[model samples]
Target: MWSANAIKSRREALSLTLTDLAQRLDVTKSYLSYIESGKRAPTPEQAVLLGK
Candidate 1:
């Protein structure tokens, strides 16, 4: 489960801005923001990709 906090902190720890992470995931920055804010969720495949 990708909790919003975990997603946010991990990105910060990696020094990655939302736009950078979103591009890596092939999603829009707005969509990534939605995920980080708990307004949306990533699919299982996306979850797996997050590990890479």
Candidate 2:
């Protein structure tokens, strides 16, 4: 499962907001929010995309 808390913690640790992260990853803030909320799962490819 995608750990919502872990994602939230990491984002906070990096001092990044959802929009900031999404902008860096070239994705929508709503999509990142969905991932953070456990409402969606990123595919391995998407994970790699986000990891960049």
Off by over 4 Å in 2: 49-52
lDDT per model vs. reference? 0.92, 0.77
Best TM-score among the predictions, by candidate number: 1
List, residue by residue over 1-52, the lDDT tens digit for candidate 2.
Answer: 3476777777889899999988876779999898889888776766775555
User: Residue 39 of candidate 1: its Cα lDDT?
Assistant: 98
Best by lDDT: 1
Per residue, candidate 1 scores C-alpha lDDT tens digits across 8-35 of: 9999999999999999889999999999
- Given candidate 1, what's the lDDT at residue 47? 92
Flag clash pairs in model 2: none
Model 2 clash count equals: 0
| Structural RMSD, model 2 | 2.0
